[model samples]
Target: MEDSEIDHVMSEIHLGCPPATIGPFLSHFTFSSYPLLDSSNDQSMTISVDKDGDLLLPRRRRRTSPTSHSHGSFTVTIQHSITSTLPDVGLQVWKSELVLSDFVLHNMSLLNGLVCLELGAGTGLLGILLARVAKAVFLTDHGDQILGNCLRNMELNSSLFHPQAIVNVRDLNWMSEWPVEVTHADPKPFCWSLQDFEQVKSASFIFAADVIYSDDLTIALFSMLKRVMSLGCDKVLYLGLEKRYNFSLDDLNVVANGYACFRRYIKEDALCDHSDKKSSFVGKRIDLKQIPQYTKGYERGEDVELWEIRYLIEGCPSNTILIKIQIKRPTNIFVESISKAYQALTDPGFQMGIALPQFLLDIDGASGGILLLWIVGVCILLPLVITVIYLSRSSKYTGNYVMHQTLSAYYYLTKPSLAPSKVMDVFTKAAEYMEIPVRRTDDEPLQKLFISVRCELSLDPKNVKQEQAKFWKQHPAIVKTELLIQAQLTRESAALSPALQGDFRRVLELAPRLLEELLKMAVLPRTAQGHGWLRPAVGVVELSQWLIRVVNCRLFPLVQGSLLESEGISPFLQLAHFSDAVVKKIARKKVKSFQELQEMSLEDRSELLAQVAGLSATAVEDIEKVLEMMPSLTIDITCETEGEEGIQEGDIVTLQAWVTLKRPNGLIGALPHAPYFPFYKEEKLLDSACGCSVEQRVVLSWTKVEP
Candidate 1:
């Protein structure tokens, strides 16, 4: 090569990570394939692996596959790997830092000329990125090595900062108290200044990325967030995270222990708003789709996410007591005393004949305590259906039938014409239009049911824009239909006489072929609307309003939910024990949901079944069997390393799971009544038939290999 070409090539030397191990080294995360900005800054980031100056480090086998990236990127110096200990793991450029950087660029308007501080700012890439717009940026972290590396990276990206940008590198330990006195001796890289402390306390925004991993470290981080976020003036914390999971012996299941630790801080309403009554940290997930991936190169996998959290101004002080709530697991006596049939039954594969959702719907809210069992289909345990208790609700629910009935009720009220018990209307309309036999009855038991989060925030006028930005996740098919309809309308409007552009449906009439063109892209289904049904009509309206910020969209491939009734049929009937005559007698009572029955007291249940509901004593006995099987089990779960109290990423921690079959603590009702959540002492008498006391424990190991 010529001298000029060689000079140009040398100028473009950038960091190169080996495939053997993972590094915070140069990697790309592309949310978009199209160019949203000109002049990519991430180019020419050459860190030579051969030499120190040629800081290009050889890659090692990474724990996961390398992600891709695209448009408007940046580069920085990163350590090949950790040299000191756990905290130094921050030395490398974690992908979370890059992911958060994209959000900063997209929301530059909010950060422009505002005080911003980054929590545990490892490599200073995120803070440096913020330096371009933030009025003042404090890149905070502990350790002289990481602090110094971050400072150097600041100089490396100095060209990217605003002309008057003030960037400070300082020490902030998560374990220490707030306003940590200046611990750095003279001549060290960073020391806390009074002014810097004030700036941090009054900052407009706080950002942290790739900071969560260890169980102990997560607690420390949460404590820091609570303390720092509470002191500041109405500041929002944008956290970027990647879930790392592991297999454990305690539950003998793969679990994200560190992530689980982090989730304990979230309240049920946290996802809805930044101001919640339950916890100080009110957080909601920021949809990645709303944030453009302008800094391209990496594939933003599903596990990676960003959260927008607000520390409620009226929150309790930092000194608020930290209650360690752990619901105790059931004892062997508790489990064995409840289900003697399981021990005595010969067939291990005996069908429970009940779906998990049906069981959940049967009982009213478990407000007292929850009975959690480890339910496994494996015969290794010989029909030991352990009820594992989980205090926290999973963020995502992936069942087909759970919310179907609710969905039907919600969507029925959407169109005034379809208001009362018109769940069957959705199907009849489609069947009438297509002239096909509607193989689905309203009571046919939904095959693939989808129950979205209730329309609490979606229908609210104040949350329109935010709801619009996130609706794609819930109603993809409906949104697609809207997109096609809009496209066709736009095309017809362009071809029509200006006067004819007003009516989209009229334009469709004007061009009969346009209707046929649309049918080509139809997402059709078979019996039961191809078995894809959505409960809650508001969910449909919410989706349409989100895409157009208005309500003119198609509602196709969406069906309503139905109720389950017990007849003489086996599994088809919800209550397999009830005969056809018994079902008719129970039907006269008009029990809308099983929760209605669950909420009744013992006397009410007996009277309603035998007298008011016109049921015989035998039928009442069958009702008791189902209710007796449900023990509001309390699950006390915790995780820690062999000797340590806190668990960090990569540290294998024992996840201890304990389940209780009855209320060992809390209220013991006088009558055989339905014990609320966490307490179920009254139900124990139902298992009098099974007196054998046996404690069984089974363990399995799963070692996942990544290629």
Candidate 2:
């Protein structure tokens, strides 16, 4: 057919008026120019709706010479008419706007390197767009009338169809296989295989727009795509629609079952101010939503509506990429309402517990004691029964039953300490006693304590016997002892007099190290002749260190000092503000003094150290010499008290002191190791006397001390 003839026919089809009026209508719209067409060429053609929503290139003509021998050429024809029983015209108009735009065209463009197939190519609009860009396109329809119309439309708009475009119009019946006369080409580089049509294969991309209006066709279409298309490559399927057209509930069900990852691509039109032409339309946004209903099953009686869909068929070794069309109402308003409600409900001061049912709280409260008892009973009985059975079976296991009994008793007596409230109070009191500053803003110190305790326990010996004993006997005692010692240390440190503060500080410094060493001793096994003091000693040493490092170091600086000179620099000062050169100079001067002290004569060092240690003339000079050359020293002492206010038997009082020798050049070494000079060894004497019973006495004269 000639381009003019096709234009005349299209004008008639579009007008839905008399065929005679088509020529006049075309002339009236200035669309009289026929599109270029060469019938001799063996190239495919295309037609599409332009931006103005009008059919582009209404006519084209081509001629080919007749051959005696028939080459493999096929003819297809299509016919379309507005049915008399149409729905609301306004709805149809809205749908037409959605269907005939660049939405499908742009998506098809994205599949440029793949073969594409369009089924139900009513007017061949989408197929034409695909063929223009995709490697190959197969435009298929059920009836001759539809195919004829598609071919005529393609011929009319040949301009958009590139030379590489290969569009084969075939009759595709969703329920059946390809017709016997159709020869399958050696699967073109790209080919659209209609579902149930065996002639086409190896297509990587599938596209359908507005195909879900019929539910039956939607299912059949997906089933067919699933059978073809290679797995392992992501097959891109783009579906464009304005959803209102679905009539059958089954249609909705088919969509819900077929596609997995469904997304919507919506087009936006922006106004152009510079040109007389209308603003161009482009796909502005893409939204992804799961079509769970399709993959699962839909609720009965729900109406199926059209949705703009983009689907991805993830390639699998066993299955091909299957595309399915589903309809859904746009969820903008529904989503907004949910989001707003969520924000309001989550706002501060909106207590979630208030909305919880009373029954929930009742259930929780009822479960607490029962749950604990159940756990304890299981823990106690299971181990005991197992141990008894094993011991009965073996003659060498006499101690097993005794150990089990001990554990049972421990569980019953010690389990209550694990209660949340008791644990919280334990931590709070421990912090207070150790003089460790506890933050008032913290509500769950016990939770933090529990985490640290768990970490410590994991690093401990994991033998079942040890774990049982430690949990029931040793651990609780350690916790209690540490807490008591901390409280005592904090209280005594807080009450120290100015004259005795320095002496007391040195005693406190040794307490932590002493306690730690004691803990190590307690855990060691001992023979029958000796009873180990390891447990008590460990408790003592840990308590001491806790008081010195955690309590004294943390709290004493915050205390206002009236009698002691503020010349001692605070160790916690931020050194980040100082320049590199300043820090280096301070470090260099300290290093120089250290070198000088290392080279000092024994007598000079002994005399110099005597001034710091308060050693008498009769005391060992070797001890004095060693003390003088020592670069740094730390001392801690702890005392346990009973019946003191807020103190218990395990309560520990601690004092800590640190001394860093001053260099002769006097730089102070940027804090922590600041300059200090001793005229007498009175401080050391005071520390020793404080640790002794009433009989101990020490004194120093300035003349004996060396400067």
Candidate 3:
């Protein structure tokens, strides 16, 4: 079929428009473009992206120091959404893109008068900058929304480019075949002509920013790169990637998975023998310090790395190898090789149409009798081994472990002769108190990580509720105040022996001093102890809930998930003062929030407390008293949806959500959310939150609005 004819016969499928709720906004990046070309060079450049709301980018609070020099500059605006699901995250520009922009703008001469292509041009902010010096630029990406936004940006910063600069927004689907067969039936824009296709083939450089994130996408990107670069060995790809570390289950450690995949495909090693030179792909990491940061906004974290990649035609032509290495272990030998031989032959991969030699088939045929016996042995012994493991672990109960460990450590810090060393000793024993081994091997660092994470206390306004946000910011001694409060609260519940009472009381008297060590160690945020990047991801309640979840799901079927389900766990910090175990039992049940936990129709609170292990009568009563003081709120919601013309796709509609909260008996007034003064729309949503005492509120009072 003629290519032009295919364009006419087939239609292009672009992703449908995203919801209007998450519509386009603008984000501006202002920076100094160095080395002025002429008097016309703009020293102050502002690049705007489509991501503006009440909040700005990461370095919004930071301003550039005044510079005396004038240089080249431009203001670029991009149309983008602030957030999207992982797969469609291309709709938003990322931190790594800004870092890459600074690198490119700083080294402008390197790209002088060259033609280049961008793999994932996303909004094309970088390409718009490239168009300034490049002869021709291909702003390519997949998906309709991404391309549409990229084109919009191109139109926005048209003045930034020279009159002769040629920039094209085109389709580059990584998963699809390259040299896109655009037929006459295809109605999509940016269909390439034979000449344009040749220009892309001859383009000297390929630019990509923050494109390495997902494993599948990384694989597809390299696949496309191999095909494209194979056509021309002179081609070099500039990849500005941010290594995002995550805990990998397989590796049992934190790793940059996307970056690891990229490394595998490039096959580049820091130290290698002559055999490495025969590898088809070569990669080199560029020193970031060598490139001055031209853009001002986000911090260029250490995780950001830039690589210069090239494909070679000089390597072994076939680049394919099959391997079978000998394997043996001292612990166990498969003397039953007769039965084990079938294990490999029955694999799914072996089921493929791969042919086997006659000798291998003869060996497998000889193992039939032994294989039958092996299966029988596994069926009988597997059950017994599981039964023994389950019986031993389930019956074991580590009672009041958290209390014994934490208090025991504090026993030393509260002494009259307490020294600086004593303070450090307490923290060093933190993991031991938490029941984590003091001498753990390299593989068991995950539990220690959880302890540090659980200890995090975010005082950031964005993370905390509006009322509590101001309190933490205004207080000069936030750490001291918080630590003192925690100590005071816990001291009341902690039943101490007479011998331990004096030292423990001293701890309460000097509570604020405790937080100083944590702050000094950088374990907690410095001045902005309450405020941070986002709402806190961990707390005592979260830690408690996590443990309960793990304990509830034992390997062997037990008396866990079989129990009654919980309505929800209230996000209250006061409950943590009672210890994580106390909160675990509360979260395990309860038809309501913290306030309603006392509303159970039991004869007394002790009746319910009895179900929880490690609680005395006095402690049970104390918990009940705390629950009574908490704020109570029950919610009822009604939604009304209707249209005179009937609701249809693409039609404007109103979504009205009527929310009402059932408050506790003594409250009087229409405003159920009067807890905070000068009520705003955002604060109005707090009407549904469980109210806490003033002290408890600052610790934690999370609210969610269903409407």
Candidate 4:
């Protein structure tokens, strides 16, 4: 190389075009083919050395032989060389190729007996690996020099490939324009020969790694992809790339334009948009999925993402090929189940039949009598047989048939200790036998079935509480069942019997989950409101009273002085008699719980009560009576000769007092200027109600005596 050329390359590198862009220029000097000189002016710069003290040449060869117990053993040797002094960088192995080679070697089953083509083959490391299992392999690159390099590598690893494999190297420059392949076509522009085009048309899989680095390269790559996809063969592309992010001077930040460009290309070409920026196309169109994380010997970094790309034909959908394979096999569970059911139904003994003595025939002999009896028996059963067959086919009797089958399934399912999943499957199969709406509604056996399933799901007595709580919150089936049960209870024609409502009330009292569910149900509108099983529960006054009783029983403390048990300090105002307007007015004052009500001062209480709707001083008196009945704990301490009640100044002492409540004790005061958040205000209110939080507190007074 001349001095001017070296200086110019350094200038380009300093201009910040990326070191990779100057790789080719640097290779011109570092290549081993450069003539050695004794003169210091012509000395070859020794960039690095190997363990043996030999120069680590710019052009290198890697010999890799991966042996698996399942696949036996195979060795692949790849040779990389610069055929020109002009510094073509395509002759070296890249990190992507190493990762891809590792992947192909580990997952050899994906390539067995398949026709594969490697785009941008470079040193042909990945193609050589594929050739070991593929029926036919094509290693492709742009110019003759790179193609020759690929051909040489294939020869070096020829022994590693299967005996029947045909590994060929071809020139494929994606930027060139080529004709669409058709039958009996004449030669056109671009460098693809007849044989090369035929090979591409027959390929079933395409592999490329680290090919997309810039917009212009991405455009060329996708153009070739579209052309190859039009070949009318079932093919998929496994593309591996370490996504390239470039620092954009305009944005002053690194951006992943490689991935962005590909996504844009997919949006423009493969999918149809309806101006809403949402995908209009449904399943099995242009399918693309990132391959799951896999490990091999190579460094597959987190940034290296592999994708499987497929172009679905207009008429055929993705996975249909596998379905066709399954059809050809014709041996699966669905068919086996149907056959068994058919055999059971068609067995001769199961069919309607009768046998009897011939004496009833009144013939000359006993045989004649036996014949007459048989005739009579057949005559009697013939109508029954006809009736059964006719009913089975009648649409009007479908519900009856479904019911019978369902009952039978339930009996059989409950007979054995089956797993919950298995029980659900049996019920699902039985439901399939019956005619069902495409979507479920809050009616019929569907609602009943859903409820039964939910009940069965909660049958684990150990986890019943947990299951019920979870189901009430998350399961739609439980929601529908609750609504339906409520409807059955409050329906006008079949009003709930006293005994049934009592049973429900007892259950709600025992189960906090039921109380919460009832509370949720009480707020729903008492009419069908949506297109689902969203009809409101029986939100009648009776049910509301039951819920209120449960809430009160759970929250209130017992009475202190009277024979009547403490009705427990009501956390909130007992508003069973209050009108909805008054309840809302009190609730708006942030006095929802009894503990919160206690935090208000006498004046605050009076001012708050004055705002209640339709409430007079009599109502305030009633509220004060309830408040006085509420229990509270107090602590009193006395120290003689000291102004302080609890302790004397400078006296060493250890004092123990039982606190009735424990609550949040974090910072409660406001900032200098900022408004207090609702959360902090809530904390303050809770902390002030400490007495209600404590379970118990006791006071003991005793006089000290000499021991």
How many steric overlaps are in each model, in order?
73, 54, 29, 16
Candidate 2 error regions (>4 Å): 1-80, 84-101, 107-109, 177-200, 230-233, 245-707
Residue 6 error, candidate 4, Å: 8.0
Task: Give me the displacement of residue 323 in model 2, in angstroms.
Answer: 24
Best model per TM-score: 3
Per-model lDDT: 0.51, 0.37, 0.54, 0.49
Instruction: List the candidates' TM-scores in order.
Output: 0.36, 0.25, 0.37, 0.33
Ranking by TM-score: 3, 1, 4, 2
Whichever of 2 and 4 has more lDDT, that candidate is: 4
Provide the lDDT at 633 for model 2. 23
Cα misplacement distance, residue 470 of candidate 3 (Å): 96
Model 4, global lDDT: 0.49
What would the per-residue lDDT of candidate 3 be over residues 593-694, giving only the tens digit for each residue?
444454565454566665553567776665555444334433333222231223434434444333443333433233322111111222222322324312
| CA displacement after TM-score superposition, residue 227 of candidate 1 (Å) | 1.6
